[model samples]
Target: MNEHYDPGQRRLPSQDFLSEPARSIPIRYRPDVLVVGGGPAGIAAATAAARSGASVLICERNGYLGGALTMVTLGSICGLYAVSPEHITPVVRGIGAEIAERLHTYGGTSGPMRWLETASLPYDPNSFKLVADDLTAESGVELAFHCSAVAVTREDARVTGVIFEGVDGRWACMASSIIDCTGDGTVAALAGAGFEHDVPNGQAPTTMFRFGGVDVERARQISRPELHACLERAVASGLSLPRTAGGAFSNQPHSMHLNITRILRDGVPPNTLDTRELSAAEVEGRRQLRAYLQAFREFVPGYEGCFIADIGASIGVRESRRVMGDYRLTLDDVLHEGRFEDAIACSAWPVEEHGAGRGTRWVFLAPGTYYQIPLRTMLPEGIEGLLVAGRCASASHDAHASMRVAGVCFAMGEAAGVVAAQAASSGTSVRNVDFASVRADLLRRGAFLGEDRLTQPV
Candidate 1:
């Protein structure tokens, strides 16, 4: 009997199928550090590694850098400055502050916008991309745009290299150390790093929109309570509004960036890895955006003659897969303003949770205080030659909300890159790198931790 033929005599198809023989993948670059995802975190990582005299390679799925900052037009660098009504010192500095200063020099950023509890620096997306490119180039890091990290090459408990797919072909690049800055924790999860998934009641995804010809002064003058009342009236008047209390900020003259659209898919958590669910979320997010435009035109004062300048390239994802690392930052740590003996970064941003409700749920830290992001948060368990940064760093859902902002990501990425480069050059594991040494390096670079700062060895 033919193997392709059924015993009952039913017609059968040919059994032969094309398969490739085993072959070696051409090594594109052998760098001291390989950073995945050229967003804020990856850019910081690559730049830091290269500046540390290590050859670095950074890849991004998109054609440009500044992942959410550019692609999603996030506009603001939250958690960069401190969060006190008085004495707003900058909690985030070093490379993060350098980037912000560049943006300000280019007239692409606004001065510190102070709120009652926290403050942030708003910047232009185009300026962010250019600044990222210039900084990364100046650091002598090799950048591969429009390439995706599809797979990994690992040897017993260690990731050796990353396989990337591009328009040209597939190639593998070797590196002594790897940093997972894919925000969604894509690379770490693929490399068998354990992660927390599908967080219950996680923050919802948001779509940011730009409006042109708006009366910026008038829009800024509208208080939060007044805006919420308008949104409530719009919903009551049968507007297809998804949320009730988002607001707009002035990005440029006569232009306002609105972050008012919320998207929630039934049976699908906001941070789901399902492609179908993500697609639906995108579509519905855009739909909600159109409705928001209509509502603003009909209900708001300054938006009567406004028009949408642009929508984000993608929906802004808030919470996602957080790799389970050496330590999981908890909500208690954030609320109590926990201080770590091995603190690598600090965040003053409150826990801003956008959930299935009319508005956001905000939990505040004590005035003029912040919590420490320990070095252990970036060291994922059961994965060697790898470190997690950005929003994917180990944190409980609420803690993630507080520390997942761009400023904290930049600090963490720089720390990861510096440590990874050191470990690579010194023939050591990332986990073996001394936290006290890391603290000294960060302090020397002008990063703010607390008064009990680490001092160099005598």
Candidate 2:
């Protein structure tokens, strides 16, 4: 049989042939760091890593960055700083605080400290996305949007690359070291690192929704009514609160972000999230959020014209997995104000717990005290070439509440970025990093030190 090729049939139009030129341009995006997630932590990590002269790449799933802050409109950043005699202090310096200061300049964040969250600030989500983009770009970090890291590649228990799902289907890029900033330890899970989801009884998870047309000033002047009280009034008015209906308020004039559901999932399953379960949680969570908003208008003060502005397209999960790091930070570590030469961030936000079918709890530190989060907590146990940041970092379920805040997450991410870059350049394992050098770098980047520095200036 003779096989003949038709030249006419094989010929392509210029439109098609243009891209397939004889000498095709090589599509190469080699980054020194591959930071996963686009939230505060991921941004900090990518920025720090790239700023250190390492080619860096940030992969984010959504078109917009800022993670929970942009998605859920989180109220305040926890663990940015702390003040106390045994203060433990915030050792995290560098790009993390720089971003915070910059955000403040843009009106999304308030100017620095003031007794924990006294100066809690808010900004338009779209604006934040721009700020994040400029930040990573300015640091010379390449960014990939609409990208999700679904898998991690390892060799002999060492991380080498992140397997991603993006516009180009499945592909991966090599990295000397990786930072697991995915809040749920998605990368760590793929890396075979150990973790524990909300312990004992599953903890409550929330799908954040926004309420617009709110009288923010009026609401701020006095207690417009906390979520619990608002629900209580609803009950009095014959409305019942969903078992999962609970959340902290956000900064939108009329918007309140709710953490109103406990998504039930098999922790042992290959996936931590399921569309069906997540949808159910969102539906139920929104129902409760609307009910409370109605109650606020009818029974509470300063909620007139307030209505559900938007519900998070994506669920804002609080806990799923905690990477088992070399040091397991415990509740006692927080209560004792533990400090370490490898300190990464500081916190004063108390042990907060949101029970799924039960209720909510906030355990605060003494009036002026704070705690230190050691660096060992970020090192995944038995996993070389991997660093965990954000909520997944090493911490007891309860300790996570304090460290999981956005401000703290940023510092942690930055630390991880620095560590990863250092490891890549020096040809050393993450464990071999010099803390003094890290500290020096952080300070140079303008990170506020000492717990009192976190205090609100009168």
Candidate 3:
């Protein structure tokens, strides 16, 4: 089956449209589970499903894996640990822990580092790509790189397959169960599933970059407050900087990965789904890097000799479309440490919101406490044979600010994979899969869904 578009039929005086003749897309390899987006979530989903005795295929739009981690050059894996003044506790385990351990072996990461009421694992983006490749390959998950999911094949309300456009043109691949790990809810949206998109009011995006020739010792000594003060000085000196306080990490000597530039246009974040606006955002993000470099050189200590080592291939979009699911995770849930009977993942990450303002808003959870994410959050409402995971999972904006990080995504993906595999193998609806069995499988796989599950027998 082929989905067709005919925008040319609508005439507009200001625009010209052309329609290409419809053609059938070739059916590619069939798999029990198809995971889209190849990011943290897709990696775990495909790996778990394949290891769970189901044939799985993961399609990534980029040439490599590690979506935002590699492509956007994210310096660290957030949401893995809960932190307080006295101790840092691991809250995300299972595939997330496994990946962290693997990164350690590859010298890709320096393990968890505590900062301003939180803890994260600092990693090298390049090494992460290799780790993702080896992890998925060893798990027997087929990989198709440079493929973008363009359309969905649906039967009633169920997603039967996805059509992807790659370098070789379009092709379709059938799957018994599908997981939308696209981060933007692209797959679910294409399948006609309802979603919420509010870019102007959503969390602002960033363009991460790296600087070389930095005085690592001096830079490391600067506290978050000091850093902000320095940037503020730069701003007062007739320089423009959208954000004063942000993250800066060094996994390599004399180099720093900076996540500081907040991309906005006309006092609001540009709609990233629009090609022109997205392109402009990318350019603006890079443009801000120069101002940042000057600010660090003139106002901040230890960056006088710093030079741009790299800029992300694209801007890091923090939020886009949050697909409506069986449950919408709320800020109250995050703050109160909400628990669910069918919990599949746990997150301690705070509600870190980036807006049009120069400073971000952070509402931290109780020290060492985390909230459980139910399986229902991944089950898109009115959709069958599909699961939505990762940043695009059903969550209120404030709640998404907590769960959208890489660690929680890994946990969510792992559960979605296992559930999808079970449903695919049994020829059952995803919602019909027994929660107890799913929880048991997740536990058996060494996942931590919360302390409440510890008393239950696996």
- Which candidate achieves the best TM-score against the true structure? 3
lDDT string, candidate 3, 1-458, tens digits = 11112222323553565556999879996999999999999999999999999999999999999889989989789998877666777777889989999998889988688887888999999889999999999999999999999999999989999999999999999999999999989999888888888777898889999999999999999998999999998999999999999999999999999999999989998878777778899999989998999999898899999999999887899998899899999999999989899899999899999999999999998887889999989999999999998999999989999999999999999999999999999999788998899999999989988894323211
**Alpha-carbon local distance difference test for all models:** 0.83, 0.68, 0.90
For model 1, residues 208-327, the per-residue Cα lDDT tens digits are 889998988888878877888888899999997878787567878888898788788763345345566678889988888788888888888788888989899988998878899999
What shift in Å separates residue 237 of candidate 1 from its native position after superposition?
A: 0.5
In model 2, the clashing pairs are 32-55, 82-451, 114-456, 115-456, 211-255, 214-254, 244-260, 247-259
Tens digits of per-residue lDDT for model 2 on 1-458? Answer: 11121122334565654332433222235566677888888989988898889888888888877898787655555555444543334434466556656776677754333432222334456567778888888889887888787666678978888877788776776777778787878788778888876333445566666667766666555442364565576777786554323434555445654444444434211122545555676666666666666776775566678777777766667776878899988888777777676777666666767654436666767645667777898898888888888888988777886678787788888878888888888888787888788777766776543453453432
Q: How many residue pairs clash in each candidate?
A: 0, 8, 0
Candidate 3 regions exceeding 4 Å error are: 1-15, 452-458
Q: Judged by lDDT against the true structure, how good is candidate 1?
A: 0.83
Q: Judge candidate 1 at residue 388 and give its lDDT.
A: 93
